[model samples]
Target: MPLAEIPLCVWRKRGQDFVFQGQAIRYWVAGQGEPLLLIHGFPTASWDWHYLWQPLAQRYRVIACDMLGFGDSAKPLNHAYSLLEQADLQQALLAHLGVDQPLHLLAHDYGDSVAQELLARHYEAGVEIASCVFLNGGLFPETHRPVLTQKLLLSPLGWMIGRAFSREGLVKSFRQIFGPHTRPSESELDDFWSLIDSHHGPRIMHKLIGYIPERRVQRERWVSAMQRGDIALRVIDGEVDPISGGHMVERYRQLIPSPDTVLLPGIGHYPQIEAPMQVLTHYLTFRDDLVSPPRKAACS
Candidate 1:
């Protein structure tokens, strides 16, 4: 599939861009009400949220961006990608959108870590995150199971391995993560492969995988943000996911105070795509709970 002809590109019409530090950053916005920022995972761009964008947009002003190095955003070769850098880019995006009011957040995979960094800024820099919900992601490196290709791409010879990365590997790795019942179609795979290979992105895959180590090194800072109570937070997980699904949820329950988790059995890593309606239901339920009044104490 040609990048421009992908489903997300064709369906989406409100796309826009802004230059940040001399690089063009692409973002999409639609709908109205309180702004809801959606951050996509690693190896993909804002298009990952395509399934949830319209529905959620009907209820909230939806905003999503192709974080630098992915999708329509500028991919600068030899540039280092980090959670903090992405978070900063997010900040810039919000600023460009003129979103000064408090906003809700929904993130998945690499995007979850980016959300954590933004949450931390909520404390350190007073960036108001009204609420947050995390989908399958490696919040705790210990629970993360990176595929063999991921390990190789992050290895010492990663530079060479990244150059040699193929569409076959992309299909195999992506397919293996989804549940047998909810695997993405060939069209979806083609779009994904096209996005990754766009603008010579595959050549820099190794550099993008750098987040695997950055996660461990910055664990204290990010995990602390997840554990804090200043902001309401919830986690929706795909139980069958081998990467950051069941195991990551287990760690979340163990560490987060008053943790809220939704388990989707038989589902895999990308619940937002594989089980979007279910994910949307859980998301709205979480948001409603955050705003709903607590029940009055029973008369004694």
Candidate 2:
């Protein structure tokens, strides 16, 4: 008997090519109900949500798109990529998709920062975000431990590093963030490498990583939105992730008011890939709790 192909291949086939800012943005929309937008992290694309797409789509309209410089999207040279620009791309894409109502947000990695920006917009009544669930990500830069490659990417030598970076180096760095038990399989890693290598994606590493410092500069604004907003918010973390694991969760609890957190031991940065069901459970619980009417007090 022959082995079956990876599940993400199905998504690749289902994805539609959409236009955003004259760039061909790769996107997938499935299921039907309240919109649940899945925002992916840095260096990876919407495929990060492949594991949970079908299951989550069962109950809600699930939408995901590759940010301008990622996945099957256009990767332009010498272009500046900022979190604000990423956020703008998100808004445009949603409007194009006819998402007029507020959206439920599930974000990971760099996408978490983008979500924070959207949260701020909601705070000002510029946009509406129904709720948000943050996965393993650098919500707090102080708590974030950027790998050496990330540091290099943010430095003046970043361009040279991006140009010289090899697939093996990327794989090694990627594996370093996963827990020992949940490292991605070889085929999965190959898929990631292929996405990054597409349209010379690696060359834009420095630009995309500019979000790190932007997080620090905009901390007060983004954090304030999460703390003061009416939306129900949750943070689910992979405890063993070296990047933003337990330590980030600690900061989140200390800083965010009435913090709701789920800690998964032995998992890593990519919880969706490592522990898909657990992530889905937490997500659905949060979504359901928000939708369910408040419990009425029993008669005294």
Candidate 3:
């Protein structure tokens, strides 16, 4: 594929490499300041942040990695792709980099689950964390509405279905989740498929999709971490996403005390991609508010 045709060409050139637990991990680091670790959702790599990478890197020390079984990372057929292990890998990655500064987290889809485990660790083992921002994901299993492809991928014939998946299938599936009006462009679809095709991603998608079920099993611990409310947390979602959009936000507001959220009315699941400026503005506002919270008036 021509570099001009695939946007990932530049992202590939700019990214650095790391080895985690004997597995090759693709991660990127840029800028300087407080560390902001980005965890991308399933079926896509850290490239998901490509839209917001430079602007974010301009301010914060940004770290993003392609988790195991996704993107440029090695996708092993034997390993069980679980969120717990993914969280462990993230911690190890930061630790390996000697990132001791208080860290902020930005996660989407599967990354959200891993972030939840990290949040739990903050309470359990005292990992320094300042805040966490969640994108559209199956955070609550009940609220997650997987499209037909995902359901089929999780079925008994999942492995077969995943292996036989095609580019047309990918486009069809994405169209369902993304807002009707904000559908992915041809180039965007090309990038997504190309990334998935890297390292036999399609072959192992079933294993990765298992996170949905894993979320239900570990619900007690992960959900408790959110309910604990120890650190600053916020949610930015695309309201039209069929999977985890407005519906998920409603559930979040109901569950988390004093919830802070932003809903992009016409947007869908991938808010960062669909509306980078909007997501960036809202995200910066959330980060800024943390630094200088609005003060209350003194009693007369």
Q: In TM-score terms, which candidate is top?
A: 3
Where does model 2 exceed 4 Å of error?
Answer: 1-6, 292-300
Could you give candidate 2's per-residue lDDT for residues 1-300 as a string of tens digits? Answer: 221233666767888887877778998899999998999998889989887888888999999999989988999887878898888888888998999888889999999999999999987776799989999999988999999899999999999888877778878887899889888888898888888888998888888889999999999898889889478888889998999998998898898877888999999999998888888877777777776874221110
* Model 1 clashing residue pairs (backbone): none
Model 1, 186-238: lDDT tens per residue? 88887887778778887888999999999899899888888877688888888
Q: Please, what are the lDDT tens digits per residue for candidate 3 over residues 43-141?
A: 888988888888888899999999999999889988888999999889888987899998899999889999998998888875778899998998899
| Candidate 2 similarity to native, TM-score | 0.94
TM-scores of the models, in the given order? 0.94, 0.94, 0.94
Q: What does the lDDT read for residue 119 in candidate 2?
A: 92
Give me the overall lDDT of model 2.
0.86
The number of clashing residue pairs in each candidate reads: 0, 0, 0
Report lDDT (CA) for all predictions. Answer: 0.84, 0.86, 0.86
Least well predicted 10-residue stretch by lDDT in candidate 3: 291-300
